[model samples]
Target: MTVSELGLLNILPILILVVWACVLLLLDVFVFPKREQVTPLLSAVGLVVALIYTIPQFGQPKEAFNGMLVIDGFAVFLNVLVLISGLVAVALSYDYLNRMGMARGEYYVMMLFSISGIMLMTSAADLIVVFLALELLSIPLYILAAFGRPKMESEEAGIKYFLLGAFAGGFVLYGIALVYGATGQTGLTGIVEAASGGLENPVFLLVGAALILVGLGFKVAAVPFHMWTPDVYEGAPTSVTAFMAVGAKVGGFAALLRVFMIAFPSISVDITPVLWGLTAATLIVGNVLAVAQRNIKRLLAYSSISHAGFILMAFVTYGDASVRPEATAAVLFYMVAFAITSFGSWAVVIALEHAEDRGLELEDYAGLGRKRPALALAMAIFMFSFTGVPPTMGFAGKLYIFRAVIQGEYYGLAVLGVIVSVISAYYYLRVVVVMYMREGDPETHSEGWLNLTTAVTAVGTVVLFIFSAPLFDWAAQAVLRMF
Candidate 1:
């Protein structure tokens, strides 16, 4: 297909976001006198516009850039999720950067760029596009992780994230090279077609897929590749950490679902065991290690890892044709649940965080129930959601995943997932206990945007549960084209 035949309209959302980000960056320097104030609002406008473009594309599947990118229900669903995440991050950052003495125009610009990359990743139909999109989304986050400049911990976080991210990128590139060598194709569809015909180098293809998994595993902070998460979350500005938790996980899983289910199903026999082990180990380590954390950021970081494991529970059944659609849908719905819960919890954290990172310890939350009842209640709701308690989206998401897992007959994993949820309650509930049971003076900052974000997410986390059936059904429809 020629460049003119690429049908660029299929990716209008991604194009608008990237173009708007570039324009925003330029306007920040020359047009805006107070970038800290103007940039976030404009950045949000960009995301909203991108989101507007995205909504119309739903159920309208097409290919762009010579079949390198696809616009489908799957892409549209994740694009909306990632864009909303970016908007929330912007809201979380509005007061935070100014308070931390780190206000700048480029922060939001970098975030916009990163978000566009995530949108691209969700639409990616080629391994080359996947690798490019991975780097595009990751590089900005590395800088943002250290946005609290000169703070030793923040600097360390940036360096650690960059080093590790670069190494992971190398893994993906090498994997692509090997896969291309094995099948003589870099496009996912082409590779799958080649595999269906019996590849000349099946072993290399298997190794390549494994390497790709390793790279994406790092992105999702799966066990054994999760060493950077706790420190990075603790040291980075809390707002950036919040966005990283959702955006990175969604992007990584988008690639995993696309590449594995679409391109590598032919090798499911070889890959399924590795995925099972990853799910089990991630669940065990993420929850077990979280139990010992006193720092809220680190605890949530580990919690994030464990949630990745929960999503992986459904993904582990990707090889089973009978179960794959529902499993994929479960993963998608769970990501939305996790995003809502994570943003709400982090908003509360941001509300209480003090300069020099003073209010970060678990003990700092004591007496919050007495002093800030609404905020404390919101936090409690988030904790319950994280623990998979009822009347919340997390429970609904987990129910979908568990049902899919059971359907796949991965009873052992389903049982392990249940056990880990029980284990997670020990740590997640500890926050609620500290908030309500203990007594101490607690200080909180209440910005309009922060409070609004908290309320919206807290309410959505619960309300979405009531409508989860339709939501899950939509997710099921989203993945139908990929297969």
Candidate 2:
């Protein structure tokens, strides 16, 4: 096939996701106004369809729109990861939404929109496309966080996210403009050529790169830029929080990888110091603050921030050499591991909360094992994974990332990562102890399927670990071809 024909094939996934999202929006607004909803089911189907379409595209390397977007192993790998996370999110939302009395069609619609943006982030080769895709993913999340309109906390979460998000957007746009001014181009390939020719304006390039990093730092919740994370995660609906933890992190990392790998390869050393500092600070701050939280959701919020720091370490190892394959693979693997664990953890939290009482406090989980052994066990599994315990997907992911860092001779960062993982174990295990060791109230009883997503997510955690090698191989191959 000709190059244009190849490019057209590569673009199919984005087209399919957009069309599916529009159809779901139409069905939700017109055909299902009075009905409870089938949007979640349909959203799952869409993800499955996307995944099926993506499988055939693996190992194919093609660039489209004058090198504005690329399809290859990396894009396909991350696309599959995003779609799987979306499917899991949809499944987890069913019971949680029903219990919250917010099981509307719009929630699913927003999810589809967010997934489309994630896919875009994976392939976008231009700065403008990156910013647009970032906004597309974030705007829906802002609304979803505050979907509980009457709740003060929900409203606060939504507004805070929106305001900060808008500021980040402006920063990203300005950065893009400055980079374009410096290199006379917005395309990744063009920027790389300019940087290579030694004719680009160094001052403008530096400033633009700084601004871009600042903007993306906010999205990934790095230290100093993570002030909004705790409150937003606490106040947002549990399902949305879970989605943000998994999907947002995946998308943010994808954008980070694309920008650094394609647009600013020469400055990896210059940027590495800044990223190292941010990663260390984020890891220490998130884990330390999490130890003080009485609320489960808030604790997980901080934990998610710390996890972002771990993922950022991969960027620290990124450089002009081919070593990025291992780093990129590590990032992708960790995201999948985190997605399943975080999704399952939030599912348990949502299942625990009911209409009369939203038991988000850590104390409320006392004796859960006695009342709901199955769920308690599931929660324990998620906690184990999050703590990087053995035989879980989380452990495997950490091994891959830390190995990459060590291979890159980033011994200090790798050591700090290990230390924080140890510190984090205390808090994650604390929840498990509360569930199994403490006693449940006589009045409390486990509700049926109010939050059954925990079981589903827990199963996914186990299965992911069992198949982790193949997944890692696929991700490694994908990143190798991308560069």
lDDT per residue (tens digit) for residues 176-291 in model 1: 99999999999999998999999778999999999999999999999889999999999989999999999999999999999999899999999999999999999999999999
Superposed Cα deviation of residue 361, candidate 1 (Å): 0.4
- Report, for every candidate in turn, its global Cα lDDT versus the true structure: 0.94, 0.84
Residues 194-271 of candidate 2 have per-residue lDDT tens digits of 988885477788788878988888888989899999999988888889888887788888898889888998777788
Off by over 4 Å in 1: 1-4
C-alpha RMSD values across all candidates: 1.0, 2.2
Model 1 misses residue 258 by how many Å? 0.4
Kindly provide the TM-score of model 1 when superposed on the true structure, using C-alpha atoms: 0.99
lDDT of 1 at 414: 93
For residue 185, give model 1's deviation from the true position in Å.
0.6
Residue 339, model 1, lDDT: 98
C-alpha positional error of residue 315 in candidate 2 after TM-score superposition, expressed in Å: 1.7
